[model samples]
Target: MEHEEEEDRLSNLPKIILHNILSRLPKKDGARTSVLSKAWEETWYTFPILYFSDGLFVGTFPQPWEGFLRKRKNFIDYVKRTLLRFYDNGLAIKQFKLSVNNFELHYMSKDVDHWLKLASECGVELLELCLPDGPDQDEEGRGECYVLPNGVIEVKSLTELVLMGGIRVDTAFMNHSIKFFSLKVLSLWAVLSRDEHAIEHLISCCPLIEHITLKCCSVLIPNVATNFLLESDTSGVMKSLNMHGLLKLKTVDVQGIQEVYIDAPCLEKFCYCPGDFDAPFKIDFDRCQNLKYLDLLSLKSSIITDKWFLELFSKFPFLESLKLNNCRMFERINISSVQLKVLELSNCSNLKEVNIDAPNLLSCVFYGGGGSEPIISFLRSSSQLEVDLQIPIDYLDLCNLRESLQNIKPQNVLSSLSLFIFQPTEDALNPLVFQVSSPPPSIKHLHLRSVPKNEILFSSVVNIILSSCCPATISLSFNPFFCTKAFIEFLYETLMERKEDGCFCGSGDTRCWWHGLKDVKVTSSMKIDENVDFKTMLELLGFGEEISFTLEV
Candidate 1:
């Protein structure tokens, strides 16, 4: 009888341990465990997380109109029954995740509201609700918006709230309502606000919110300025999203916003993507002393002048990483920030000159194409630098290109140099081929892509570059039509010729350059009618054994 009692004790785990085990299992699997014995029946009911997703009940009905409706109804009934069982058992729910893809919100609005209230009463800490498109969709099927009810926002026990779908926030519920004292993270996707104040009031209530992500949201009005947008401007016109009082907030990611006023002193990271239509954004950093990472993209109208740029760096003295994309404001950019480590500038059409004086910099990338070449200079030698040139075919001139290449100073630390040249049929390569000078000796990787007719020019360019830099790896991206076995053989012959011409290591050692080439990658997915296997061809040519071939089809 003592042995039997010990076995029973082992089978009957403590309530806390049993609840934890069941909570980690899928809802259905955990519930099915109740069939094992009466001892396990109550364990499933007390499971903290109740995740009811319609996807779990897929294929329950036939693929037809009636079947679709039946499945949605069954999902609703299952969730209702599950929540009711928890209530009947007097169990508390700590987390809840609900996803309904097909249910009509107008018919099930009452049920959703009741479920939220039940979850709140059960002390739910994490709530995730994904509803279908809006109840009142337009005739074009373009609008899929859902309005969130008050019970979800008023849940004081919620620590993390993620509301997706075209949900509209009812600001009226925020006034005189209970604050979310415990809420720390809020994520809203395609959420529409009734007015700007509604969002402001909602944010004021969540004083503990640390991370906020607003993607494809509209009608965010600022309290400091009356320049507000109407609810009808669904074209993603965001006036302002002020971060004034939430001192504990750390990271904010916002897209499709026009203007943002940030005053949070403790903010560490910020990502902003401005829309097509935007006013000049105003950002004051009197309090944001802890700001570190910033990414700004799609700056169409809001140009950053030299003075404004200096002021920005001064305000955020501790910023570490900065990225600017498609911003066409400053013709000349000069930055001298000590704390900056990584800097990237891309697609700045009007930018002509860039001078950086960051001592702690580690990585820098510049993308300039189809315009007058920009002059880039680094005051201090830090580490890796990548220069990518995508000059247009119409503007392909050897003199201008040579001048642009000469403008970049102190090229001893460049790691990768990539050039994409597009030459028209009428353009002659003789001028550019001879003018193409050698690259920096420190470059370790070189990539070249050009039109098939300009193969000789590219070959000459590559030879010049390899003669100077002698990179260990070379990658060639080409149309399959031109990248035949003969073309690769020609490249091999060129490298051999360079080896014989005393171009290897300046010591006249033939084994230094060609033998040192370690990797050759050819990326071409297009099917070539010509039958050519790169591996067999390279082997037949007696390329060194140490060379590895990467032929991606």
Candidate 2:
């Protein structure tokens, strides 16, 4: 009776469902499930997905070279055995992923080639291979690399391909145009090829490819200044993506490219992250009428002036989202997009001011360093606007921050408001707390983030702001390095005093006041002690049902 019940309850799932359940598990775990029953053994053997990571099988390799060699052999043997078992069973694999870190590619190259060829012959649909990435790689290309075999590229059933870290294609395959008959998405990260034109040729050959991401694939010059452009070596191909003749490409992300010349007409979205070199980039967007998003990041020491930035906005009348991050060389950014809805800026160290007149804008985020506070203005009123700002604690001038807040002119039903005070210095505190010039009214949710050392200033600022705006929910990011013992006690005392007496006022000053705040939230990184019972303290204070406490590890 016990055996019958076990079979009915645990082993009754259908074969297809069992196979799917095993497919999602790790390769080792899936193989171990064969000990469950005969039905599970058959299901494990037929599972269609295999993912292997050296980190999962072995911990960080220590100093001894022999230890590394032993672990590397074990990793290789595990993959070989898994693939061999599937091949012997005549089972088709839908996807194969292999990620190795801190492994000598020179010794494992042959094994990798064999595994890829086996996966290709099994009609795999998706293949991903990732290796370690390092900027200190040998310039003369003496480091270990995988020269991908032709079988993997010529696989007729592969629909997605992702290659990362020290990957290259055989020079023999570059002689003729190569195409992936079924590939729709291709991503390359730190991939090296013999010819820069090979990437362009490959994109041209992929008739169905739509999305491409090339991340950190540029080769660096060791002691070169970033202000001047580096000359390209046409004799040898560099690791950069050249977007030409890609008619169907909808999205393109070129990250850390030394030199790029792009002409993708049908692109709907584009992102460019220029590397340290100040090389020239030519992007022809004349035919990208459908383009709606453009992102630029880490363009340090850029030669593009404010005039070019304005021209870019003018060129794409339909652009809806624009994000700029750490793109130096501009002091003032003025954007007037009729259709723009979202704008974000972060870590633009040289930026001093921004004037945006987007009538349709709905949200904006601004974050930067402490050199000088940038003046942000929204010329047109956005009825449904929300803004998130992260500013340096000392860089904030009370008058300027008030002016900037008034510039937005948020509606009565504000979408949201988030303020984070970062990099608190000794100069941040003043004798008297400054009042918010134009306190946001009717904030839906308010978040305040600060370190424990600046708790006094953070609390004083929160008090002044809450005196103006009445937000429905308040969130706090509390670090407990200093205030672990007395943080909750401080909140409890403040809230109880405010609750007992409706508001506070000076003897002869009518302007001094406070609010009857009912809701309180406390999130800390550690719990202090059981003696300080939070629930009992709140109960004694006569507050109920509106308090929340979270302890984060």
Candidate 3:
């Protein structure tokens, strides 16, 4: 009796419990369990979620065309047989995902349409279709794309719909009435539409959509004689996206659109990237008062002025995170907010000064450009605030780096600094004796990354960083093709040879802080015993891509 009890506990589980276990596994893995036992096989056939993709046979084909044809036929036959079995058994499909390349869709569009119709009839709640573009095309210079079937749109059980790449929402959709009554999340990426109104009409019908993403979508509008249509044209791109009265909407990300106007009061996050920077760009979300995150990119300096920031904070009182990228700003800008916590600025090259006064700000990231670093001042800030500075690769000079360190108002507030350095054409790496005038800042960590052509450049970069700041920890990541063994050996030997009374530059200047170093620890993926020799440590690091040195002073 005891042996029988422990024989097969999994097969004795209830059917509902066994089905739940199979639902969490990959489709291939779930199918592999059919040979386990008769009870497990019965549970596998009743799995409600089905996902089919041509990606599984991508690299399996050794001979290009001959192997691809065999893989294609197998994939199609498998999908048809599985769906027919579920249909014959009267089982419900909760979710269905199909991904195929452009080459496969050209010959199997009708098969895809049949599968989608069956999924709709079986009440699929979540449906995702990904058809990426390929090099093959027809005589009209247009790639083959699958037109979305009307039967799929009429499904009242769908709660999430994601369609990406090589899919067309054509005039048939515009003429038919959409009935996506239960959709809550809708994402359309790189989809083509016949006219601008087709996409807008689709969005207006989905009243319950909470999260929406429209990116890289193009609209081909016919030439109309009316002035209203011509005035609103955005060339070949979507002219404008207007979302109003979406009460349940919370998140929206839109890219490659000329103008955007949203009036959703419950919106919490919004990210927008304009299609054309030279043309006039207009964005207004005046009614979204509860927004917490906003990211804008590529806006001109004439649009975002000092007064524009003042109006922005006043409009959205609850915003906590803000990111700006490649958006030109005026000479001076001021950011004063009480609810802001995270701020990031990237390649805003025109600005010369920035004044921040956020008492709750936790972190700020600044990426320097080719010009001089901006003067950053914190009038009022949190006591635990941290700052990150990223120096550009082209501006990686000792003088420029030192000037950046001195510009911070309260220099001790900097928590981390990253340097992207390369070897200079001039002979700045020559062994010359230089003296230190003052001690470097107290940085908690310093990260150095390079793709240098040789080991001499790597050594020079490390020497320049040590002279800049005295970080407690130094992390280095470099090209793997370089002499890793030699670099590690050089680093280990130099750190162990430094004496408490010796100076790095050999200038007899005791002011250098490294003279007081007590110990150095090197860390990598492989473990190193404290009793390990120098050669053993180098051997361990030969296979590691990144290594860190922790200094004890």
lDDT of 1 by residue, 335-395 (tens): 8898898888878778888888887888777766566778888887565545443433232
lDDT of 2 by residue, 293-362 (tens): 9888876655546787688777777889988888675777778878989888877877766777888888
Of candidates 2 and 1, the better by TM-score: 2
The local lDDT score (0 to 100) that residue 53 gets in candidate 2 is 88
Q: Which TM-score value belongs to model 3?
A: 0.87
TM-score of model 1 vs. true structure: 0.69
- Each model's lDDT: 0.66, 0.65, 0.77
Number of clashing pairs, model 1? 3
Q: Which candidate model has the greater TM-score, 1 or 3? A: 3
Q: Rate residue 179 of model 1 by lDDT.
A: 88
Residue 242, candidate 1: Cα error in Å is: 2.9
lDDT of 3 by residue, 1-553 (tens): 7765664787899878888989888777899988888888888887778888887755553567877787788888888888888888888888899988624576888999999988888889999999974223666544466789877778999999999876878767764456678999999987777778677778878889899999878774444765342212333678888898789999999988888899998999999888664677788998999999999887764777899899989999999999998888988999999999999998996889999999999999998875688999988889888998887664235545666877777787788898765555565544323345567787888876543444555445455566667888877653465324555556656667785433444344546667777998877645567667556655566443567778888
Worst lDDT run of 10 residues, candidate 3, spans 226-235
TM-score of each: 0.69, 0.78, 0.87
- How many steric overlaps are in each model, in order? 3, 0, 0
Q: Rank the candidates by TM-score, best first.
A: 3, 2, 1
Ranking by lDDT: 3, 1, 2
Best by TM-score: 3
- Model 1 segments more than 4 A misplaced: 1-63, 81-95, 101-104, 132-144, 220-236, 278-280, 369-373, 383-408, 417-436, 444-470, 474-553
